[model samples]
Target: MKKKKMDDQHFDKTIKGRLENFEGPDFDPTALADLRYRLASITTAPWYARYRTELIVISALLFFTLFNVLWQSQVEVNREQSFIQVMDSLKTSQRIIIDLQQRLSALRRITSDSSNASSKPMTPMAEGKLNEVDNLLSQLLEEKGNNDPSVIALLGQVSEFLRSEPGMNGDQSPPATPLSLLPSATYHFPLPASSDSARISLDQVTLKENGGTAEAKEKHLTAAMARELKKHFQKGVGIRLGPAASLSAITYSPGPRVPSVGGGLMSDWILSPSLSMETGIIYAPRFYDREGSTMMELQNLPGVDESLGSLKEVDITSQVVQFPLNLKLYVPLSRRTEGVLGGGYSFLLYLRQDLEYGYQFNDDFDGRFQGLKSTYEQAKPRFYPGTLNLSAGTSTLLKNDARLEFSLYYQYGLGDSGLEQVKANSFGLRTAYWFTIR
Candidate 1:
């Protein structure tokens, strides 16, 4: 063995010496340098570069969602603007009638006081004023269907006064009041019994013939009306509708707890800026299992006096309808977000209950048997007294006058669950999307 080892070492030395002295054909230094550079350039790519495709897909989805929200917001704004314009037009008509009433009253007083004045040659300015008033009255009378009874009566009075002028037969017209010089204050005159029945303040009505041009005054009034309407809308009552979902589990029951899922419609009525009332219905499908009592059936056996134990289990499935009513208080959390706390009651209706039983016999029995199963169903509808509900949530405003909400809730059963004296409490998370209506 030692001689073989020495021979191996001598052979390795001879090969090493021969290789060290050997020489091959010359190689290009440039080619070797290029190969080394290429090897050094290879490296693992960054995570972002490797996952660029997934990132692009996610970004596209986000962009689409944002665009859709923007479009819906624009639509809501346009609709509100259009409604404001319609209201402004109606208000303008009401203001015009009130203005005419005031001028008519002033003209009647003047006619009564000057009834005994002496006749004189009509001045050019007075004639022009009379013509203007007559033309305005004629224009109003032409549309008899649109004029109120009071307006028609005032027009008639004016016509009579014009005809009975003190100097009409002597090529003259009586002194008259200019429309612009009429009182620009509130008057207590009866209006038509309609939506515009309430008396209007003259100060609120922009005087077209006063300071600025009619067009400019009209635009200003429109902007002012819009602002007022928007303010009222913000502070006034509102309503919303949305779908809700929850994940819940039962407590203090004979059965093992399970996950319950369902969805339903929910609505809220804003009673004030920071307070609201909520009511809705939810449909829930539930499943649970409880340990069952042992039962035994056997033929004549040797030592067994009466019976033997058999494994038994019961599974329950139910469909329930929940009616919840709550009062929620809101506090602002940010520019577009709010935190809410609520307490209320939930009424439950059991639509269906299905109980399934299974039995497995022990092999100690000589009788040939495997397992037995049975199903019992109750179709009668019943009510589960009620439950007290408490919740905490956050609401985020969306672009289109809508809101998104996420909440955590707890419910304490007020009475028995009507299932073998089972009383249960439940807690879960809930989410809802809501839209606003004013």
Candidate 2:
């Protein structure tokens, strides 16, 4: 009897194993259960003693496993798509920032231009409008869209776009035809476009018209963009114009940073030396991290205001001096001109000189000075160890990778930094430069 029961159990196990093997794409547990139920019902022989619900449950479990794998595949696909979208956003924001920086720097020159080079007189409103346009351009460029491009390309696109945007005619009202767009006007510089190829130039555009037939004006805007692009390229900001095609309003060859936790060293590097100039911000200071705590605490501070140490019996919290950081980002022009922006840690060591001591005892009381020999030491005890620095260097490149770099170096204090009263906290110099042997 035992042997016969064992044989029956083995047959049932074989049948269940065969049923569990079948699966379909995007396996639906509900569908599998129904299939198993139907199969069990079709083979319902009373002597067979079919466990119909058990078969269906086992089939559903197998299908669920298959469905889980498909769901995971979809998750992986979604993650990849999300990663791509983030990277695109970073590139776009980076481009917009770079564009706006270049734009405002150009506008500053147009407004402050004292060259008296242009024959036409610039109106105050026109100048104000130029500034406004700059602001608007900057704002629009930040948002990633199909229209965004370099200033020249962007202007051309803008002119084309405005043709479909029916604008108000100074009456603070919408146009009659919403679909039919009006064209914007382009503003030339106060000076005539010069023939000299040595100088640089910049062109301003106006979205409003000074004359009729705005459609023809839109086509002319393209010409304006080309002209400006040529000028900006050859002469830099407000420099002279070269041939229209000579200068490409491009972000050089660099596209974007590689997205990795620690990206591998660049595989290929391209160098193109031109008489190119640009204006942008850079990291002038070392990013602070808690990597060097022990070494930092022992150092002295530069430009510590002594006024705070002497205010025991007086109200002089307002007299405390805090030195703010200032940075300069230069645009390079020619092999002779250069710009730099870098930040790093600085350790201000002890002053290499003796201290000059003078104190005012009271207001306008004529008193003789004396160095009283107390137990207190007269010299500074602590050495000024400066923290990380943010620096920029502009220079003219010379022979054999040697360029004379004029640096704007800022030494920021980490723990004990303060401005020395009645003294300049920072100084600029036309410093020397040494290129790294790569």
**What lDDT does the true structure give each of the candidates?**
0.64, 0.33
TM-score of 2: 0.21
TM-score of each: 0.46, 0.21
Model 2 per-residue lDDT tens digits across residues 1-438: 999999999999998988898665796899999999998889547742433433443455446445544544454333224434643443344334333333333433333343333334454543443455566576555554434334445566446533432221121122122111322223222212334222112222112222311111111223333333334333322211110000101110112111110000001010112222221111111111111222232122232234433211110011111122223344544324546664544333321222222222333345643322111112342334344456666656443333445555543344442122111123233243332122
Candidate 1 TM-score over all chains jointly: 0.46
Tens digit of lDDT per residue, candidate 1, span 1-438? 999999999999999999999998689999899999999999988879833543554465446446646655666445346655755654544444555555555555555555576666666755554565665555555533345664666667667766775444444444565566655555432344333343344555555664412221333343334333433445457788766778887775544567776667788998865788999887766676665442222112112222333436566677777999999998766646778899999999987777766656656558766666666677688998888999999998765667899999998988877443466788899988776655
Q: What CA root-mean-square deviation does each model show from the true structure? A: 19.7, 35.8
What is the alpha-carbon lDDT for the whole of candidate 2? 0.33
Could you tell me which 10 consecutive residues in candidate 1 have the lowest summed lDDT?
297-306
| Candidate 2: regions farther than 4 A off | 1-332, 351-385, 417-425, 435-438
The top-ranked prediction according to TM-score is: 1
